[model samples]
Target: MSFTDELSTVADPLWDAIEGHPMVERLGAGTLSTDPFEYWVRQDYVYLVDYARVFAYGAGTAPDVARMGTFAELLDSTINTEMDLHRAYAAEFGISEAELEATEASPTTRAYTDFLVRTAATGSFGDLVAVLLPCMWGFNETAERLRERGKPDDERYAEWIDTYAGAEFTELTTWCKELMDDVARDASDAERERYRDLFYESGRYEYRFWDAAWRQEGWEL
Candidate 1:
C-alpha cells in the first residue's frame, strides 16, 4: 500500500469518529445550530492564520525547489484565497472582519495549530507533510462523504461541502498524498513509524477541533 493508504488504515477509526461527530453530521444535514457554527468559524479563522505559517515553514524546509514552490503557493492560497472565503462566511453570520481579526483561539484550536507550527519549524520536511496531510485529506473525505449523501438544504453548508469536495481541493489533497508517499519511499522504518505517529496525533487533534466547536469549549480560569 502507498504510505498515505497505510496512514488511512491506521487513522480509519479516528476519521470515522470525526465524520460521525454531531457537528459534522448536522452540518451535512443542514440542521446544525448557528451558535456552534459561529464558534467554529471564529476558531478556525485563527487556526488558519497559524496554518499558513506552517506552510511557510514547509517552504523554508523543503529539500527541492519544486516542493518549496508548492508550499509557497499553498501559503499564498491559504492567506489570500481561503481566508477571504472564511471572512465572507463569517460575514454571513454577522461576524465583522474586525471581529474575526480579534477572535481568540480556543484551547483546541491553539493546541492543534501550535502542534502543527512546532512540528513544521523543528521537524524534517517529511514530518511536516505527515502532520499536514490530515487536515486537507480529512476535510476532502468528509466533504465527499457529505456530498454522497446529497447536498444539504442549507446553502452555506452546501457551499462548504462543495468547497472541500470540489476539484481544486481534491487536486491539492492528491498532491499531498503523493508527496507523503514520495517522502516515505526514502525513509527508514523508524522514520516511517514516527511519521505514522505524527499523522495519527494530527488526526486526533482534528477530531478534537470538531468536538470543541460542538461543545463550544472554553478554558476555565
Candidate 2:
C-alpha cells in the first residue's frame, strides 16, 4: 500500500469525522450560516499566509529543480490564486481587504499553523511533507466527497464547495500524493512511522480547525 493508504488505516476515523463534520454537511446542503463561513474564510486566509511559507520552505529544501518548481508554483498560487478566492469571499461578506489582512488567528488556527511552520522551518523534506500532506489531501478529499452528493443551489456555499472538489484541486491532491509516495518509497521504517504519526496529527488538527469555526472558538482572555 502507498504510505497515504497505510496512514489512512490509522487515520480513517478522523478523516471520516472531518468529512462528516456538521460544518461540512451544512455547506454541502447549502443550509450553512454565513457567519460561520465568514469566520472560516477569515481564519483560513491567515492560515494560508503561513501556508505559503511552508511551500517556500519545501522549494528551498527540495533536492531537484522539478520538485522545487512544483513547490514554487504552489507558493505562487497560494499568495496569488488561492488568496484571490478568499478576497472574493471576504467581499461577499462586506469584509474589506484591510480587515482580512488584519484578521486574527483563533487558538486552533494558531496552533495548527504554528505546527506547520515549525515543521517546515526545522524538519527534513520528508518531515515537512509528512505534516503538509494531510491539508493538501484532506481538503480535496472532503470537497470531492461532498461534491459527490451533488451540487447545491445555494450561492453562499456553492463556490466554497466547488473550489475544493473542482478539477484543479483534485489534480493538486493527486500531485501531493505522488510527492509523499516518492519519499515513502525509500523511507526507513522508523521514518515511515514518524510520517504516519505526523499525518495523523495533522488530520486531527484539520478536524479541529473546522470544529473551531463551527463553534466560533476563540482564546478567552
Candidate 3:
C-alpha cells in the first residue's frame, strides 16, 4: 500500500477521536469563541516547547553520528521557528517568552511531554515519530481546516489560525509525514500498532490538555 493509504488506515481511530471531540468540532466549524481558542493556543505554546526538547534529545541520542547531526539540525530549526511563532502570538497577548517559559505546564501537558521524551530516549526512531506525528501532523491538518472554514474576524484568532496553517507549518508537517512514512516501511506490524497507539493517545491527551488550560484560573488572552 502507499504511504498515504497506510497513514489513513492507522489514523482512523485518531480521526474518530478528534471528530468526537467537542472542542475540535467547534474549532473546525469556526464557532469557537476567541477566548477558548486563545486559551488553547497559550497552552499549546507551552506544550510545544517541551515537545521540541524531546525531539532535540532524540536527535542527540541517535545511534549514528551523521544521523544525529541531521536530527539535531532539524530539531534546532523546528525549535527556533516555533519559538519565533510563539513570540509573535505572545506579543498580541501581552505575554513574554520569559513568562511563558516560567509558567508550569498543566499536568496533562507535562505528562504527555515527559512521555514523548522518555519514548524518544529509549525507543526506536519509528517509535519517536509515532509519538510526535500526531501533534505535528494532526495539528497542521486541523489548523488548515480551521483556516479554510474561516478564522474568527478577531485579530488574535486570525493570528493563531494563521500561525499553524501558514506555509512554514505546511512544510514542517510535510517533512514529518515523509519521515514517518519512510520509517514505517520497514516496521513490523506490532511496531506499527505501537506507533499508531502513540499517535492516538497523544492526540487524546492534546484535547485534555486544552480543556484543562481553558479551565485554569485567569487564563485570559
Measured by lDDT, the strongest candidate is 1
Q: Which predicted model would earn the best TM-score? A: 1
lDDT (C-alpha, whole model) for all candidates: 0.92, 0.89, 0.70
lDDT of 1 by residue, 76-106 (tens): 9998988887898898888898899798788
- Over the full model, what C-alpha lDDT does candidate 1 score relative to the true structure? 0.92
Model 2 residue runs over 4 Å out of place are: none
Tell me the spans in candidate 1 whose CA falls farther than 4 Å from its real position. none
Question: Residue 192's C-alpha lDDT in candidate 1?
Answer: 99
- RMSD per candidate (Å) reads 0.8, 1.0, 3.7
* Native-structure RMSD, model 2: 1.0
Q: Which is better, 2 or 3, measured by TM-score?
A: 2
Candidate 3 lDDT for residue 9: 65
After superposition, candidate 3 runs with Cα above 4 Å error: 10-38, 61-70, 217-221
Model 3, residue 115: C-alpha shift (Å): 1.2
Displacement of residue 21 (Cα, Å) in model 2 is 1.3
Per-model TM-score versus the true fold:
0.98, 0.97, 0.81
Better of 1 and 3 by lDDT: 1
